[model samples]
Target: MSKMIFINLPVTDLDASTRFYKALGASRNPQFSNENAACMMLCDTIGVMILTHGYYRTFTSRTIADARATSQMLLALTVEARADVDRLVGAGVTAGGRADPNPPQDHGFMWSRSVEDPDGHVWEIFWMDPAAAAGDTTGVDA
Candidate 1:
């Protein structure tokens, strides 16, 4: 079986968060979702579990940081092309997310932009040339 990643997040409103993810193209997995939590599948291998603060607390003893005020981690998703990166970020913004919480990055071979969900979780959308990523600069513009 292929390994999968499930990023668990604390959300104040499960329905809103679920809607936000759906707008960003993630589908809900009903089998693993309930009233207190929703499992949003970003892809076959990546999932985001949005849980209410009370339910999230049951999993760990650590405090749940308010993402709006604190920088926990930057989640990144790669796309096939630069246009795709922009499209995803734009879709996020149209879905009630904030655009470019972090400055946009354009390094010739790679491009990236960020968007913040309503709860302030940052998602970096990026694209990198396959040749450049493989360290092959021949014929590929830097």
Candidate 2:
């Protein structure tokens, strides 16, 4: 297994991406950050690299997705409670993100809401209830 979880995101401007992610409660890891790209730490080990399109292309042979006009990443963040899921999704929307075209889904064991970041990256905030899951026999993944 790897020690790091790297999510390479294509951004038109690195600084803007850094600021946008900061608004969503992420801190820039200075040890792995510069003007062209920066590691936005999501957790102790997970990070999303906000790399400039040109700089990121070196890692792949294909063209970068124009995230401003289309989708590229679909990230799911699971919380401990349903209210937390909704609150986090709402916070993202308040910070210039967009909510998905669906309502909060209650899957007996879990509830979820999806949002899109300012750069069109999809994020699903979910909450699982173990007690509800134990009671329901057919609870499926949300």
The number of the candidate with the highest TM-score is: 1
lDDT of 2 at 60: 94
Per-residue lDDT of candidate 1, residues 1-142 (tens digit): 8999999999998888887888778999999999999999999999999999999999999999989899989999888878998888888888888999999998888999999987999999899989888999877766
RMSD (CA, angstroms), candidate 1: 1.2
Q: Pick by lDDT: which candidate is best?
A: 1
Give each model's whole-structure lDDT: 0.91, 0.75
Q: Candidate 1 at 58: error in angstroms? A: 0.9
* Residue pairs with backbone overlap in model 2: none
Candidate 2 lDDT over residue span 3-25, tens digit each: 97878887776766676667556
